[model samples]
Target: MKMKCLYVAVAAAVLSLAACRSSKDAVSVNDLDGEWNVVEIQGQAVQAESQPFIGFDAQDGRVYGYTGCNRLMGALTLSKPNKIELGQMASTLMACPDMETERLMLNALASVKSLKCSGKTLVLYGADKEPVMLLQKRFEVVPLSSLKGDWRVVSLYGAALPEGMETVPALNFDVTANRVTGNSGCNRLSGAINHDGADENSISFGNVASTRMACPDMDTENQVLSALNSVRSYGLLDNGRLALMSEGGTIVLELERSK
Candidate 1:
């Protein structure tokens, strides 16, 4: 009887040590300290939109990443043994023209409950649909500063306007002023904005009230209204192209600053 008890105690100690190691290997912010890309989003198709995921220190034991359209930051807590929870992530106020795609990415990340490593792929899933963030391991990121300036629009979405409606006209957005005051296709218009000084990426046009001008091209007029009302996020991309991308790479319009 005494010999059996000794063996049982030794076995328990070994099991406990193994459990500790497993828990340590679980997913945490420390493990996700580098860049990542969206290899597979929402368990549907795989679209690697953002090249490199940028993770920066939030000074609060959390990590932040730059999605193609918006800034994402969240908390990570690793409970014992296969139990993990990715806290609610907060994003900047940029209305994506492609609302569908942006919503999917945000929803996936928000749904991360527990994560596991499958070879080189890091899969994140939830016990339920609470939050879902599935990301693949990625490499370094190249910081670009050329993406800064006033951009204009080239295209838009939504319904066509009446004969005299201006959805959105030729716009010249000044990031320095944190304002987007420009010609609304026909009339002069202006509104507030928020700029990312480091990258010139900005957002604006919430509740923009413009002068009711009667233009010959009602399409332009209706477009002007849609642009202001639907303006969500804006970014300065390569080649001096300022893209006002909506919910899903939907380029509401692309404009160039005056050289």
Candidate 2:
């Protein structure tokens, strides 16, 4: 009877040890999934009003986000607990006064070798196992369904109002009809948008058609049309701005929600 009790105790201890190990090794892609706003780089606080952000799309093994001034996309691979690898990244080349911060961010991303998450905070480590970047998970303020409203174009091809256009461009999405119509600053535009299989943060538009109205500002219209046609995905920024991106994850158009 004493031997039986000893055996029971040993079995219980073994089970307890296994449970502890499981808890310590528990890691999942969900831990890294979501939008994370840049808080610090190499222990220096990020001072930009438009803070950079990054997101991990576990479904497609893609990581994308804004780098203060330019949009960036890259490949991400996660191997269980605490093992992560970020592949070569591509970014847009929009000139901004805050290019210094963008450069710092891009450089840090290139050096990232692993990552650790504690609650809503994420820390990226470099080759020497030193923390290089700090980020906090960002929660969406508006639902993706809210994207069906009217939006006023704020920028096209990453630049402010094109040279001669005095009027602002606009885009309107009719979610129920799966159709979109708008003014491309110099022409009337309409198109079919497909959100059928899109997630809350991504969408694609069909071929957009515009009325051929010759205006002195055809330059702006052409830029707008090109941007709209190339849009392959969309994301809403923390400040309520809407970004339309191409397949390569470059921000082609930016807009603001209009009442």
Candidate 3:
């Protein structure tokens, strides 16, 4: 009778251990949602804090973010348990000194076959079941009041300004006055901006007027003016960059917070 009780106790212990292991391995799509910053690559720490990070939009099954040097977009699939698939990614081609890190990051993302999330930490595993990268939840949310500041134009229509432009375009958003004043390459522009609510995700420019000064090249000014007129919303990207989107949800301009 003692031997029989001992056997039953061992069986119960085994079942409890199995249940604990199963709970630890369980993962849901919700665990993979939200923005993540790459804190480590191949067991090495990533020192570039000003670089781009990754974000997952679970509602759309889309993943997008900056890859240190370029903007990347791809599909995310979580169809199977304990597995994930990152689809072929598309990115903007912008030359930068940190291209090596971007290349490795893109490769790691492409090779990811599984994922594990613990609290705010996320780990991606390759096909061989080895950790390829480690990411932490990015919690910095840009406030509406932070949008009122001076910004320098980084790109217009996805391209940098000419080498010998008379002056680089700049913008200054005044939250108090509900106005945006800036130099559109050749002309000084000022206009009222609409802040619908407390949500800082969307904004609109109303009736912008610019000085009639004509520079040697109106091409840049013309492009800037057109982009500004079509501006429908804006968002703060990583590294203190501002993205202005059009009515059709196209990014028309990217600006950096002026030092």
Candidate 4:
């Protein structure tokens, strides 16, 4: 009986401590309320064009923001009033004109190990000795038509175009007719293309038809096949080449209209 009582008391104490810790970690939505302007971005002085910084807010302890380019959403657990664990973030697919600035912002936010506010300045220090970024409260305006179009590949891996293969082949696609007709780099192929057609994009190829050619470069052919299968985003460039990027914006293949 005594042992059982002792176990119950210990369990209760543990539960109370856990509850307290959870409450301590719970960040209120009001804490993140209001706009946050990028006072200093990537260690550069803010220019007139970069005046409007991003805005962030906490909704039920979840963090959401606009990084002057795309929508940013992530979770954060407040360990204390001045310290927190920045969770993984997912953003929209709008390609920023200044990709370097956006990348810097993302890297900075993702690397945030701890954060604190001094007067009106919010200081964010990244993980692993990364540089610090300072932000201030401000309002912002977002554009609607940021992402759109039929994109091509800026480049491709494996044999840029395969020489030969039977089942899988080197390939290229065309976006005008929503069609993909190419040498599977070894075999001849044809297919229908489908796309979301939004500035924030999502696209795919339909069933593909091909003339099975048996040559060589099986590895290149595999790469082509993989690229075709995994195409989720695309960027229409100034050049005729349609740069097809992956979900992570990594260029997987470039498809130019075959003349």
Candidate 5:
């Protein structure tokens, strides 16, 4: 009987150590510095046209956000890694067609006991240590400096690229030289980027010439070149995506961040 009791104690100790290890993996609360678009609740995507969002003020230790129907604000506190405590959250008493999402978000804030943060994503966990909410960084305005990196084409002209292609279109920005170099589906490309000079986000690609290698997807490469010429601005979207925009605010190409 004593041996069985010792085994039970050992098992409990192992479980406790596991929980502690999981908590240590959480990122510092200070990581949540910018406004983030609420993407999911309890693993379900939010389909409402009105996008819900949340922001944190590290210096002030305060929280503020919009619920797609009303505004919310509250005191925020963090005592240790993975743990977050939001004081009695107060929201504007506004009514809308549906308030289910709003209720779920507010409840999450109240019940969440832990959290995890990645480069631009944040997840909130409840007492059960299960993720209750997911959010991604949202950029209202993008700067030229913010886009200095490599990117790969995810979608072309609002449609997914065809599969089984020899090469996928991609671009690497050299901000110092004001040049972009990469593969344009069927050929190697080199180009110059011109800042609109009017604003930080307004940009245009110029003299984007490419190699003359004719491939099976030459048609796709031609379309890609046209899209680059028409790009007038850019925006950072959720999930680390960049959207090249046209004159009419249409997304001409969607690129994902690459190494």
Candidate 6:
């Protein structure tokens, strides 16, 4: 109970000094569907590199998203038109160098009383009905849970692998352990994954180590390792495949969740 109140205080204390803005979009109350990327808090632009986002599932009566530092989730209830109330919130315990963004986000969210969402953009208002935060709609919100389990390698740099290849490289995401274990198609692959689970398609691999084994598929293994090392973010495709994107937004590695 105290922690919850602390969040409210954090938001109120930080946001009270922000210059308020009037709503300019058409009134669309309680239209908090889909995923949204936090663009601004109290008119202060969030760093472009940080991926802070939120998702609302009204039908499920829940809210979830990645804070700038950790994964956060809670309940949602809309008791009146244009009105909102967030239930107690819970989040992961990971700490980061810069937690100000997360603090601003949580503080602003806790103070949200009403909002004007125009389907593409949302402006959250505080108790004074003054805008506290701005959010832009994002396409295809990927749940962290979706990254779990085994994924079969489908393509390398968008090119399909040789047909009938016995050794198919794969990736396994163990979110709980914060580790990635899989095959480079020739060597056993293991590594650490860095993700706040918030930035739009935000994820990266680090300290990847693999067993040295001579195989005819070493070329494939090399390509896979290079791809994994270069991964910058991830995306969920309409076809239900997970795309491990590289620098400049290239789909270096494509994966399908194993059945």
lDDT of 6 by residue, 1-259 (tens): 9997986675445334322233443232234665677889998988934468788876578888877677788887766556777877788889898788888888888888877765467888899978898987644557666798999999997688878777799999998887999998878999998886556467888999999989887778899999999998777765788878675445689899787
Per-residue lDDT of model 3, residues 23-45, tens digit only: 25545555666567788888878
Q: Which stretches of candidate 6 lie over 4 Å from their true place?
A: 1-31, 140-259
RMSD of every prediction: 12.5, 8.4, 10.3, 15.0, 13.0, 12.9
lDDT of 2: 0.77
Superposition TM-score, candidate 3 onto the true structure: 0.53
Per-residue lDDT of candidate 4, residues 142-191 (tens digit) = 12122223222224541254322233333444555677766645666678
Question: What pairs collide in candidate 3?
Answer: none
Q: Which stretches of candidate 5 lie over 4 Å from their true place?
A: 1-26, 140-235, 238-259
Clashes of each: 38, 0, 0, 15, 0, 2
Candidate order by TM-score, decreasing, is 2, 3, 6, 5, 4, 1
Any idea how many clashes model 2 has? Answer: 0
Evaluated with TM-score, which candidate comes out highest?
2
lDDT of 1 by residue, 47-138 (tens): 44433243423224565665566777777665433455567888777775555656777767666666654433455676773324545544
Q: Which residue ranges in model 3 land beyond 4 Å of their true spot?
A: 1-55, 64-111, 116-123, 131-140, 194-200, 229-252, 256-259
Q: Model-by-model lDDT, in order? A: 0.53, 0.77, 0.77, 0.55, 0.79, 0.77
* Candidate 6: 10-residue stretch with minimal lDDT: 17-26
* Cα lDDT tens digits for candidate 2, 88-164: 99988899988888989989999998777766678889999999999986544344467787999988776778554
